[model samples]
Target: MSEARKLLVLVGSPRRDGNTAMLAEGVQRGAAASGTQATLRFADDYITDFLRDCRTCRRSDGECAISDRFRTLFLEDFLPADGVVFCTPIYWYGMSGQTKTFFDRTFCYYAGSYPQSEEVLEAMCRKRIGLVLASEETYPGAALGIIHQIQEFSRYTHSEFVGTVGGIGNRRGEVAHDPRDPMRGAERLGREMFTRHYADYRADTPRSTGVWCG
Candidate 1:
């Protein structure tokens, strides 16, 4: 059997019981069923002040210049995960601002600011990534812009973009009631996290944003 891996799920929705959160919960359920250790965090739970531009702060050590909750999130929570799952609700054709804030904090991992970035960043390369997104828009491409960013980020970080589950619902907790069973798709994607490749899985199918399941 594969050894248990630590999976970190980041819920980017400020609404604790929103559609995205339900998707995240489904993923967690699947992770737990597979006997993987999983942890869930809300983006709003982290203190994300606007990244102050400065030259004299800490950078060479490969540490974030900011001394807020973001630093703790990076050094303690994010880096330690063997895999990461990003669950967000689309807003204005992009991820929620709170979630974006967490992502924007990655600049702290740059060579100048974070001297040990190479080590931590290299460690991240070994991890896998999954995405679960919800949107109010019903169009097939509603979440593509956000998905593209995530795909690029995965590549830049050297993490394998394992799979995605994009759901559509304007109301809170609609993911559970969607006809397509997006929660089921999210759970399946989570279970497949230990074993599948997104490229191979989507090889024969055309990319469609309306397609919520993997």
Candidate 2:
């Protein structure tokens, strides 16, 4: 039997028991059912400060010394994951501040000139996949805008843009009422992608290019 895939799920919602979490939980359930080894990382659990724009990551070493919880997660977990699921709630027509800061802190992993280290690039190019989960009430348009940001992140970071799940009009576990909710879709997307590209996964999907798992 093939070894199970290592999956990393990042939850970016401030509300631990909100709709976003509910959707994330569904995705987690689907992944677990597929026999994939999954890890859940919550951004709210870790207190992080704003990233001071000092351009410290621009040096040849390309490392950030902001001294926060982000540093610990990067060194210990995120960098080694086979795939990533990004779950966040839309706020102010964009992703939550917590999620945004997480992206900002990724600077600590690379060099200043943005020279893509082979390992980082490989992580992006190889088994990397992105899943976005967002929630909105009447104004789901904002959620669409936020998803663009996630797509941009995928392109820039060399991660594969698998797909996105937008849960609208449903608060709490209302999304669960819909059998075909985005959360379930997100989980299935992860499993399908892993299955299709199990052995010879390609990361040469190119950066700054638009690709969707639709």
Clash counts per candidate, in order, are: 6, 2
Looking at model 2, which ten-residue stretch has the lowest summed lDDT? 192-201
- List model 1 lDDT by residue over 42-92, tens digit each: 877875576556466555653556767876676677888888999999888
Each prediction's RMSD over C-alphas, in Å, is: 5.4, 5.9
Estimate, for each residue in 1-214, the C-alpha lDDT of model 2 and write its tens digit: 9888777778888877777777677667767878887777888665477666656424445555455677667656677777777888777777888878887766545533444556655555444665565554656576777777766776776666666677763567665665556666766765664564322246874444434455
Candidate with top lDDT is 1
Error of 1 at 10 (Å): 0.5
- Between which residue pairs do clashes occur in model 1? 59-112, 59-113, 61-115, 62-114, 62-115, 63-114
TM-score of each: 0.85, 0.75
Shift in Å, residue 202, candidate 2: 15
Please report, in order, the local distance difference test score of every candidate based on alpha carbons. 0.80, 0.66
